[model samples]
Target: MRRILLGAAMAAMLAAGGVAPAFAQGNPFQPLVYVNDSVVTRYELDQRMRFLQILRAPDGDRASAEQALIDDRLRLFAARQMGIAASDAQIDAGLAEFAGRANMDVEEFTRALAQAGVEQQTFRDFIAAGVVWRELVRQRLVPQVQVSDAELDQEMQRVIETPRITHVALSELIIPAPPGQEAQAMRLAESLVQSVRSEADFAAAARQHSATPSAENGGRLPWAPLENLPPSLRPIILSMQNGQISQPLTVEGAVVLFYLRDSRGTLRPGAKEQVLDYVRFRLASTAEANRIAALSDTCADLFVHARNLPPEQIQRQTLSQGQIPTAEAIRLAVLDDNESTIVSQGGSAEILMLCKRQSALLAGNAQEAPVPVTAEGEEGAAPDPDALPDREQMRGQIFSRKVGQAADNYLAELRANAIIRRP
Candidate 1:
């Protein structure tokens, strides 16, 4: 299933230049297929294929591009049925947004795309379809997604109660398993693993071959503790060292290979691991750091002048050391309670004050301390009205995923009932 982004669709057309208008009789608008009464033209199919090519999709296969176009037509037809066609202004807005990604204005992007061979109208149509479908999904699917306070609290409690574990920084390549194509995908994945010698090579392979959304980022996963990983994959991860690639492992509906980038031990705070109380202050200039060093006698007074600033600008949190990102663990570890250290990440420097540290267990093999479940008749404790930012982000992520799945399922239903014809 293609997630039709306006930018990607536009890129395809621009990269391919415009489809040659000259046909058998100098006529380009030839019917390639029909979905019910709506038609997909040969010119449109060729343009989409070129778009997919510029995307560096697997093999730039014509069949896949054709399938994507067919789906786009279906999406457009559905939009009309719902009386929700995109306005011309909406299409322009989408085109402008897409151009912004390339740091270009719409006029500049349009000229560049034209030079590359894509027609302005073709790009506009692509943007219109995506814009309309997005509106349709927002109207139909978003209202159905709900994340209750109880659900958030239960998850938060679970995270706090789970013990800390060694974390592995990993990247993955996932090739889709489309029924009869499973064996072929596995063989390809195996070949990739054998040929990839470095992180760059693996990332390049992922961009060209992976079917997962993460392919856009070269399959890099966020830093995560091993305990949070799927049980079946954890053992295999533990066996591999940094920079090592794993053999292809088949999971439900896909074949996956992992590359271990780095590893570290961390405590997950929500799992109720040992909490490290710390004060953090962000620094913008060396002068600020120097001024603070000269004036502050203790960690408490370091932020005395900045107390009126936003709390998040200098907030204090009691968190697990294991919960600290692998990159900052070393700097934070060397400090004692109330002692402070300075570290810079992504060009921004910050000072960390170690307020307190509690030992729950050693570096490895920490056992879980069970949280008591209340009796069936008693009312459970009211969930905190204020959920963490991470919890809110997770909720949004879950909602988006549900909407995507609902869109796919809705499209499948449309395909099932429509009279689809191909020539």
Candidate 2:
């Protein structure tokens, strides 16, 4: 039954024009590579490549597809050795959940993939491998992960003390690349990136070749907040060390470069840009609010106090510092996570429990950090919105990153020991 489903899925993909005629001309079931005792068929390779293309992966070439399949095989083999297997139900749920990302159900997602020349079995295989690997890692590696309180405290302190960069000094140069001159402009910009080592060198180059009006001042620009630059350029500018020149950036009609003069950080008004997540529980009196506050150690504990109350009486909100009302912001600014403050709202007492505070920049919604702008005066792409986690969440993030690195290393070891070969 499973074989029939897999074949039908592959045939659907082919009939829907998923595979190219050249790929279809060959025997699709021919074994092309071997991993230990398992074989990777030519059909699977073609399916995997088509799937990657549909996903619009940047490195979705034949080599990347082959390597990915090999890795999946190794992961599955490891799972089998450990007696970790993904059940049919888990795979079905995984398929549904993955399809939900595209606002579709499993059947709809399958049809969409078929339209793009990807088989349902290819998608199922991908999800099953991932599910099995996750279960395996949870059982094997999660027990090895440990985070201490002192480490959490140190990380929290570092986050609190790190000054936010509010302003930067930069020198810019834009080389005009007209329709027919783009390659020439890019070459010139690349050359300048290598040769321009100092502020003087950048200024000289800017004055010599720059087309912007700022070129008259050796491309010198006054200190500006990253917000004033394009969203795409903020990280680039922040990444540059003092006196470092940026790589050549191609714009529509120009190739641009920047020299970082200096950057300054501030702790004051910059604090207002932070994003706060908190819970507000309405109480009948100040006394009740105080009692609840005293009993609760975290935002989750507030739910216990509100168990008998209406849902509307308890509200959770995530808002930027600037969006918060002045009085509320003042009270919250002084409170740490899980700490509470009683504020009067409509003659009733409300307990505001701080859940977490994160930098707006890290949260990816700071108005102060504007989109990126090139020296050519063109607006660049905006930054994607990201939620910045609080202390506990940060700890989890750190742990996850560490675990991921460890898993990668483990996988590398497995690959090293396995007998992988081309047929």
Which candidate number has the best lDDT? 2
Compose the digit string of candidate 2's lDDT tens values, residues 313-398: 99999998878889889999999978988987665799998998775654552232356899998989764332123656767877
Mind sharing the TM-score for model 1? 0.48
**Model 1 misplaced stretches (Cα beyond 4 Å):** 1-27, 57-60, 153-262, 269-389
Alpha-carbon local distance difference test for all models: 0.69, 0.78
Using TM-score as the measure, the top candidate is 2
Q: What TM-score fits each model?
A: 0.48, 0.48
Q: Which stretches of candidate 2 lie over 4 Å from their true place?
A: 1-25, 157-162, 165-389
